[model samples]
Target: MKKILSILCFLICVNAFSQILSSNLEKKTLALGEVNHFIIKIDNLNNQQVSAAAKNELLPFHFEEIKDSIGTQPNLYERKIDFSVYEEGKFTIPELEFKVGDKVLKTIPYEIEVINTAQKGDQINDIMNNKEVKLEPKDYWELYKWYVLAALSVIALIVVIFMIVKWGRNKKSSPVVATNQTLKELDSLKKKKYIEEGNYRSFYVELLDISRKFITKQYNVPADVLLTDDLVQLMKTNNTISRDNEKIVEDVFLRGDLVKFAKTFPDKEIMEKDFTDIREFVKRSSNDLEFENLRKDV
Candidate 1:
């Protein structure tokens, strides 16, 4: 009786530690170029001990991103994968499996439908005829008032320019003032302790904003408006900054994108180096601009 009772207790304890696996899809149907999430959750398992020997095959759908995180419980792990399909069709999401300890957990395969709304219909709506409007004296004034304001604006701008030039002759040029203000902004960002608080996303956002503004001001380039590739291309084409400095800025911008959009956290050392690189770029670029200005003046 003692041996039978001990065996029963062991079986009960084994049942209590049973592993669970589940999978979920955000949506069954998605438009072309639209993203969807596929999530896999495992309970009573540590992700570190789990090995994905067979990779999930996403044939029709293009795999965009994948991220994993611990769930509500310490023993629970969750993985999210982002995918999109360019061609419209029904595709099967292959079964995913992972080995946790001695047990292998598998997720059942599911079908996802990809759709293209643009090719759905050929019906074209008729274009309505334009309506004619009668204009009164007030309407004429409203139309021509812009010209009047423009003339006044031009006159005001000329007067303002004259006053600025006269004031400038009395005041000595201070290029360092702008550079100092930029450096002070960087110093203020450091004081915020964003990295210490583990708010790397916000830190990168603000860092990129400040760097873009500095680039725009120092190089007279539209850094804030242009995309990363476009901005890099413009920088290379203009050759206002050295290739090494441009590469540094490009790397920082790409890392910022990964942090902001992809939810990736880079190494703390890399983050610090990016900040330092941007600071050095500002100072070096400013000095170069000042030298060029002085040469022009001479």
Candidate 2:
């Protein structure tokens, strides 16, 4: 009888100090940019206070976190946190520690798989695929009438100017080279703050445009007209730009293409690196071009 009583007392004591910690995710897999719900529950709190340090918690990059609850009941404690990652990949939620009076309880880490929803099936479509909509004839007329009127007005103005000057002598003027235009434009691009605004696609498009234009003018290569692969090939053939610099340009173009076409958003560190490398590439290439011109003049 005494042994039985002792066993019961031991069980009671264990229950008083013991806590049940469990972490649950609504789904292990999610579509890109979709929120995943996570819940943490603790039972048998025994009236002891439960608290978690905010500084100890860390989330994946670009993942939005929404804390729903830090619930407390007579013997129960629950926390709900929602997380969503803009980029697709496998991400983990690290173990969270909760202080219960003197002791700390930690939850196990959870892995989340994020996949692109648009590329789920065997059939692959463009990320920016245009959907066709059937419209009435009146709708087409309504949309295009203003454009037609604008085009006709432009044509009439051109015809009038041409008739006024039947034949004109062309004057050849010396072209003025704009100094450090690409670097100045890069500074202007920074002022726009497209990345901070979450307009990554626009940022990449403009970044590529600026780089391509610089390459075209500096190397006399049609970088703006060539495809990314073709332009990278052209850069590879250039003896003036070092192989390392060529790789930097190639990486930037390829990553930019992914952002523009595949809807991929890289971390800010990579974006900053691309910006820095492009600036370096432009500076070095500009100096090389000037040196070549000086040698030719000599």
Candidate 3:
């Protein structure tokens, strides 16, 4: 009888201890706006390793294992709960139940109070105004028409002024008088015979000036201000002369530069070649306009 009584007392003590271990819970409280944290630690009382699947029955919360170097136990699981609520009221974090094989463990409920924050700016007014506002289509064509009319008026005024000036110039002068004046100036210079006297540098300079003047009068190109390269590029872009004619023009300018700037003494043959190139260029270009006019007349 004494032996049976001792066994019953030992069994009751063991059951009480098991109930106390299973009912262990960790509870926490925090403000709504504040960062809230809760931790539930479970020490593995069993001899075997425990899995996190044992805590899957928790509501409104979840648990993750924590790695701690100071703990002697191998399976010390930690469950952390973060409470996040925007409303200003009391909220409850439900109890959690973790199952490991045949045994179950329960965790306590957590509570948090959420409060409203003070907001600045006219946010409600801006939202109401934006919702009521209506956009109207812009009339761009009406605005553009005035600009187009103004541009046309300016162009017409310029054309009238140009016509009046051109008509006055043509009416006051004769073509024959202009032609005679230019020819007489050239003739007087030729009679000076500066080139035949071996003044090659001066001769080339005068030739370049005369060619520039003729081009300015005949083609309306600003030949006096143009460099040889600029003139060549212009001629090529304009297709003003044939390939053969362009080569002749280039050679004349190059040879003239050598004589005037480099002080190059050319033989009689080269001097004669330069004169021939100049004469041919002038004759060909001058005749082209008349030929074009005749074709138009026909």
TM-score of each: 0.54, 0.40, 0.38
Tens-digit lDDT track of model 1 for 32-134 = 8788887787887643465442223322224444433434456877776676777778877666656676666778888888888885568878699779999
lDDT of 3 at 117: 58
- Local distance difference test, per candidate? 0.75, 0.75, 0.57
How well does candidate 3 score on lDDT at residue 282? 62
Winner by lDDT between candidate 3 and candidate 2: 2
lDDT of 1 at 156: 100
Return the number of clashes found in candidate 1: 0
Error of 2 at 168 (Å): 16
Tens digits of per-residue lDDT for model 3, 62-123 = 22223212222544555554434445666765555544445666666656555655566636
Q: After superposing candidate 3, which stretches have Cα over 4 Å from the reference?
A: 1-186, 242-245, 290-298
- lDDT string for model 2 (13-114, tens) is 997779988888898888887877888899888898875633213344455775555778978998887877777788877666676777778878788888
Regions more than 4 Å wrong, model 2: 1-179, 290-298
Write out the backbone clash pairs for model 1: none
Q: In candidate 1, how many Å is residue 60 off?
A: 20
Candidate 3 structure, TM-score to reference: 0.38
Residue-pair clashes per candidate, as listed? 0, 0, 0
